[model samples]
Target: DGQKVTVIATDYTCIGEPVEINVIVSDLPNAFTPGSDGFNDIFGAGAELTIFNRWGQVIYEGTEGWDGKYKGKKVSPGTYYYILSVFDANNTKTTMKGSVTVVSDEK
Candidate 1:
């Protein structure tokens, strides 16, 4: 003789939810030298760089790249402050502020 069997099934669904985003700033270099020997010739203002003077005047702004020059001229040797802001690929925004020193061999 042979036997028979029966089966039952169920259905279900999942829902998605929104989440809050946070921003962070990292990988800040301690120091840099802007010599003209072709190595380390340019000064970096950090990621999403935005440099400003003591008076809060904007000196430079760019995307993690700087040639150590402003207005087609080399900047003097000294310390400068910079503010960095960025939005990651996930559309999250972050801001950071820090200081940097610019040195020259002629000094």
Candidate 2:
């Protein structure tokens, strides 16, 4: 039997591309405690967070995040509304709207 031997070489390159992730907030909490419990203590930073009262009044606004406080006082326990606008480098803006309750104690 006559046979011929052949060798094949393969080359590959891992071309990587920068990937942009989705909004960091996947599970938006409906409530949080501002105390130092190490839990949902602060709002998402870099987000234009505007919290409104039940009457649609801006109760709190901060870019560093809200600690569930208004005017250095812990807001009362009640249903509050919020709007979060996140701006990226490309000027792409994402918005999230929901309600959050401020609780004095963990429940």
Q: Number of the top candidate by TM-score?
A: 2
Error of 1 at 84 (Å): 1.1
Q: Model 1: runs farther than 4 Å from truth?
A: 1-25, 43-46
lDDT (C-alpha) at residue 87 in model 2: 65
Please write out the lDDT profile of model 2 over residues 1-107, one tens digit for every residue: 11233444444765455454433444677888788788878765567899988899887888988888888988888889999887655567878999888777656
Per-residue lDDT of 1-107 in model 1, one digit per residue for the tens? 01222333334664444444443436555455665777666555445788776677778889856666678777777777877776665666677778877777564
Error of 1 at 90 (Å): 1.4
Q: Global CA lDDT of candidate 1, please?
A: 0.64
lDDT of each: 0.64, 0.75
Model 1 scores a TM of: 0.60
